[model samples]
Target: ARPRVGYYYTGKTGGTLFNEHMKKLTVQEFQSIPVVINDSASVYDAICTMFLEDVGTLFVVKQDSILIGIVSRKDLLRASMGKQDLESVPVSIIMTRMPNITTCKQEDPILEVAHKLISKQIDGVPVVRERTVNDQTVHEVIGRITKTNITKAFVHLAKDELHD
Candidate 1:
């Protein structure tokens, strides 16, 4: 049987504290940081930087702080192989649009986030916060959670469990 996506929502408040603590530790302690690219950025430039940074994904965003899409390394490679000129093609053209992307909130439990990665067959999730300011809803990206983070957390838990 395939690994089941664990629904480990350990409540919102406690999850926040846990995520904060993870962030305070080394970058490796937390999940991989979400790489970002402007929607207007040239595909060539974005892909070049992504390769230089050694990251697998990039979150495409608009000027107004709205998430537009996600571009993975595979997506970039596929686009590059196509007939479109990299210099003229924008990331937006090849990005996975908003409604099709999966995301998580900072307050979600690390375990739950891990399950999401498994169930969705994704490597990571973007964290976002929705705020109602002046009666207008605004979404702001807070952080990212990934498979690496969950694995670290599980290792820590396993060690503690063994000790007990």
Candidate 2:
């Protein structure tokens, strides 16, 4: 294994290179635009926004894009079946509140986010940045990582093989 000649196999294979490339992929490189809704919005509004955005999940936030909660399609479906009028109800009532929400930063590995999406059995996760608001820690919604984003990254990763 001594470096005696040029172009000698260093014992690294294509698959190994691919694995290394995948591990280095970060969430910022593959995340999509975050879909958000005001915490005060109604369930009806949430449903409308979901449809309009064509996204599976929505981040609920306050005035400054500070993440307050998250809402999924399943949550909206359940809320619709409730006896209360959708307009009269606030989305905050159905959203999975902060401190309980699963979030990732821009620098997080895409593979890690993919693992989270699979193990958590969720549709998406918001990419956030932490900030201090009145000495209180809050997350700012920046982007989103979803199964679709992961799939795109996978496609891009395998693009080199397409030429062969």
Candidate 3:
């Protein structure tokens, strides 16, 4: 039989080493409530919704809440600067549509989501789940994973370790 190993300070038990635990954290544990908007909504309404919800990103969904696109503060700002009237312009004109929207599932590792946010240079990503409704498949936006959430989790982990 092999000899048993006791607790050893291998420089992996605290502080930055806490990141190991964070990497294994599931997205479901850190994902925040998703603020959604309809694809057909006007840019004016979308902006208002963003302000009311206090979110920088909005997940655009169909009438059935099927994920279709994503809109960010930058998109709104650009559209607002255009000559076109915000009340008359639909979000579909500026929203990043499906197939291009980066997403993470609830079961995805938080580190993976964090890498995606960093690699894509985005503020947030929608957390979705594939579901079949009326025999049609759709990605349903259930929550959101953002850089803020990841940072918050990391800080929380470090603080907990320090206290221990």
Candidate 4:
């Protein structure tokens, strides 16, 4: 007697099933709502926001929520240990400024963002979209993709496999 085997997904064209296809999942599937802070906000403000949101990273934005920078736990720690006063030091001075911040779109593959997180040695990336206003283009943050989210998705996939 032969053992029975269950298939995950079967396409109409009889394409590959399971087969590492989970990498095809898009960022929109797993991304979480972003925690944003204004560029002019104080370093103390950034620290408080991080604790309140329980997030490792914060996207720095301008008026209208246009992304201008990114701040991390490491940045805040370094700033706090420095000579500047945390209550008076602005986040813009410590954040990774524009043109250097890495971002992804909603339709981007989650696998791609995961690779970027590893390669760039960062904890997360802001999910952004371009908007046109009066003939000018700007990037507005919509969500955030983080290592924790990826791990959660991986666990979900493993659970599915076990049940199958």
The best candidate in terms of TM-score: 2
lDDT of 3 by residue, 1-164 (tens): 43467655665656566667667788998899999999889999999999999999999999767899999999999999889999999998899999999999999988898889889999999998899988977898899988899998788777866786
**CA deviation > 4 Å runs, candidate 3:** 1-20, 134-136
Model 4 earns a TM-score of 0.86
Superposed model 1: Cα runs more than 4 Å off: 1-32, 133-136, 162-164
Residue ranges of candidate 4 with Cα displaced over 4 Å: 1-16
What is the per-residue lDDT of model 4 for residues 51-76, given as tens digits with 9 covering 90 to 100?
Answer: 99999999999998899999999999
Scored against the true structure, residue 40 in model 1 reaches a CA lDDT of 92
lDDT of 2 at 164: 58
Give one digit per residue, the lDDT tens place, for model 1 in 3-113: 468555555686686676544443234555567878899999889878887777788877655677888888889998999889999888888887788887765666677
lDDT of 1 at 142: 57
After TM-score superposition, what is the CA distance of residue 116 in candidate 4 from its true location, in Å?
0.5
- What TM-score number comes out for model 1? 0.72
Model 2, TM vs. native: 0.91
Error of 3 at 80 (Å): 0.6
Alpha-carbon deviation at 111 in model 4, angstroms: 0.6
Model 2 alpha-carbon miss at residue 128, Å: 0.3
Q: Which is the winner by TM-score between candidate 2 and candidate 3?
A: 2
